[model samples]
Target: MSKVRIYTLAKELNLENARMLEILDGLGVSYKSVSSTIEEDTVELIKQIVAEEGTGSADGEAQAAAPAESQATQSQATQSQDAPEQQETPQAAQASATAVQTRDDVAPASKAEIPHRAPVVTIMGHVDHGKTSLLDYIRKTKVAAKEAGGITQHVGAFEAQTSKGKIVFIDTPGHEAFTTIRARGANVADIAIIVIAADDSLMPQTREAIAHAQAAKVPMIIAINKMDLPQANADKVKTDLTQLNLVPEEYGGDLIVVPVSARTGEGVEDLLEYISLNAELEDLRADPNGQFSGVVIEGKVDKQSGVLATVMVQEGTLHVGDFLVVGENYGKIKAMMDSAGGRIKEAGPSTPVQILGFSEVPTSGEKVSSAKNEHAARDLIASRASDRRDAEGAQVLRKLTLEDMMGPLTTVRTVNLILRADTQGSVEAIQGILARKESEDVKINVMLSGIGAPTEGDVLLASTAEATILCFSVTAPGSVTKIADNKGVDIKSFRIIYELIDEVDRLMKGNVEPVFEEKYLGRAEVRMVIKHPRFGNIAGSYVTDGSLKRNAKAKVTRGKETVYEGTLVGLKRLKDDVREVQTGYECGINLDWDGAEIGDIIEASEMVEVEVA
Candidate 1:
């Protein structure tokens, strides 16, 4: 009879090689390793043993489950029906209560008296900075080629066994979503490595990683990558990092800086050694017998598995078949795989594993834990869903009220603003003019002034400082307005410079009303560009949609980027002059700006003043 390898047989049995090897040893079968071949007779005997032990299958009929969408719908219905007591509370209250209860169940097990486990390291940095290359060297795999847009699109977890011990790495993708992923990675990480390219060193994304790491309060190591390049400068990197508060150990700071080449694998061993040493000092621990709980590092819906999550166990061991509440979803862990893609029955503390069998993909960083029972898990998750709804409502309704403005009435009055303008000249001019408005009783502080539409970043800064946004000759987009609304951020737009100043002056006396906001009217695509001596640029275009009226403010766009933003000087149809152009009709457009090009898009819009609220 032909022989089968232990690993090949383990895959058929959905068992890890270690477990299969242990079973073989118990059977008194002689084997060299997992690579050793076993006779067909031995395989039959193992199957018989597993069957008799009732671990193989059931004596009943097997029924195919409903499709994924139908099953998800059924689960939602079941959850609603199961939580009657929660229905009595208001939606916001119910959501808040559920969120609290769910969080309590999902919180990682306490570290006290926990057992020691492998350190989980998160690699973070700017794009094209060798973060993935270093991971490739360590794992002996080239995975970057498979990534979309040549960037890691999702957080990946894997483990490597070395002479010292096993190390876990959570490779985070480099994208704008890094804001969330990097933060989550650091939260569950014992150590974070900031990969700085030796040549182009610090970039904007690098600063973002630094801020995330510092906010998470995790130990950070510096990896000076690309030492093989001609422009590589280790001293320059060290100096730059020192200025950014990542002081090197040699420079009397706590950070460990290692110069390495991810391509040639130079200095990698030293980096590993330092990480292991740092892990020793930190003495990270997990309770093997504690309730299995962790956080979702990253999650996505899979057509095959339905919902998949890359989870990192913090305190206890997570095993297949345990009922779990992951974020706002509840399910039994149907299967678990180690970082190596080997099927593992259980995951211990600090172990990152790919989990299957969730009804819905959980949010990254959401608490994941084993509940007392299916009912308990469902209830906890349902509550969390409710709490999230309540939280979102509370955030939206928590706008500044008249009663909250008592500070301006009694104490030293202060109005913090983030100013944005259409031009640098306008920004400078506004800054100079606003500086004159500063008074002892009512000081006006422009916290973060810039030149452009009010952005989400401005909203975040405004939220942080409890400030309002003021912009001139620039309109906030619908998307920006939506975010600002969600954050309860107030954005006031003005056309004339004096109008902006007048509103602020009115605010000192606590009198304010709804301000003007732009409403987009139509869009036209230029098919022909003509120049004239009197008119700067004449654009022959067709109205793509809506109606473009004469003298309406228009924005010219090249591809997806906006190029020129100004009002139309005139509108004409062939030889006759017209007031507007409607859909499916072509017209000649005259603007004060030059350099109008074919294939350019022009969008017309108007500003309408309304009540403040």
Candidate 2:
């Protein structure tokens, strides 16, 4: 016969293990440790006995009704149990049974199931502020004995056993890491510990982290770390926090400020104590017997374990044998392990565990839940995947080149552009020609004109104005490309003059690709950098593989990172000027820019577009 352990039963009933053993004292209920099993029939009997004993008190009856699965049990039982002002009456049992229904009959009904769980804490702040050290100290206490330096290296989540209480700390690399998770819609953190280096006070990333924590509406705790340093200034850190609206409790504000030297383990105990006190007031709790559901911290393939998932349980208990679906992947929990890598058979709310046996790796921060069976898990995965496919299709942009002539714009459609070029004269000429194309049907407007590559500010302006950026003879920085991709703003670059004008005409006419296409020609290696007193920096070059052409568009790169992009001003074979230099030949080249470093590479390309019939 199927059975459950006494500890599991205790968890289901929201009672301590000893309290449950006390209630189960009987001839049939013989057991030793909390892990001892009891028959199913005996489990039901214990529930009835508890119901009988609990009916004497109103609060007990309301809580007892939680075990009932029916229309009647779905009502205001939670409110009655929570509201201390509520009085007990004989009708409390029946009233609790249908409290959820009465809300539907009287007012518009909304259902939300919020159970208590361990506090989900995310550590944030500027990098090198001892965020890692403090977390390492807390972790090593529960996990190891002697603390070795640099033991912490981005383990997603870990549980620490402090004297006050246990806390699940989610360590983030930095504020950007925190925001990346936030951008994915994971608001699992209940409290954010903003670690600030005492001597440094608050940096840009610190302020950004503070704003993110506040935006998430989670309470913040200030940790003034590196207190062991001679120049450490805790007062200055607190003052900076005050400017950001996070005033320390000692400074007449509610925010708790703890000074700690993780290096020496000073004041670290106080921080843990405050976290416990705050958790008590937060009243974190969870229904251990309810449906299993949680958030996925991360999922990836493991060489030894196939697909491994780090899960943070929010409600109910997750057993090893239970089947679950994470995002589009479904699996039965073949094995379970805690953050410490110790084998475990079960995971409770707020506990982070490694789950094995997923068919495929799910996205990080995905929602995870228990399914009734394998088929149910598969069905849930199928439905979720279909929803995602539809949503993604709607958001994808069709790769529209600036030269691609779109159909006549709608009355509200304004072809706003932020124009950039290598010279102010070029910028003026482009803006003048674009302004001339303005007509009754479509408007070609330049929102901003400048003589440098398109910047993040330009991308933001384009995104706000619903426009594209057309850069002439310049390259957008790497940062600009990333932001442009995220914001869905088009950034197209061209070197030739007539090509830009032709593309503008093409876009205004109809949907057509640019008349002139680009062709990659050659590459050259800068073996030496020669800076002339009058003439700009000259590159002693060797045609690496492709030929180098004078007056051709070129990009100067330092290793994999780009330094500058412009036309090659001049190319020389020995001392004489040349139009092109072939492969294996050594030459001297004058690039448009002056910051040419040794070991830089220059790439040459040309514009070549065949007309389509």
TM-score of each: 0.51, 0.49
Q: Give the alpha carbon lDDT tens digit for every residue of 167-214 in model 1.
A: 888766442233344333325777888899999887756765665565
Residues 1-613 of candidate 2 have per-residue lDDT tens digits of 8988676687688765656777777544666445457889888988887777677677766866757655355446666677848756769867886786544234323222445566888888877888889888887775544244423323379888876557898855455545545555666777889899999998845765675565567877888999999999998888887865666755766677889998998988878766765675566877665677788777778776688888888877999989988767788999988776667899888988888888888666677888989989889989999999988886585555434345434553456666789997998788777878877887775655667787665665555456678889999999999999998888889999778887777656643444677788888888898887866888998897878888888888887898888898898887799998999999988987888877888899888866554
- Candidate 1 backbone overlaps, count: 7
Off by over 4 Å in 2: 1-116, 143-155, 389-476, 483-613
Q: Which candidate number has the best TM-score?
A: 1
Model 2, residue 238: what's the lDDT? 81
lDDT of each: 0.76, 0.75
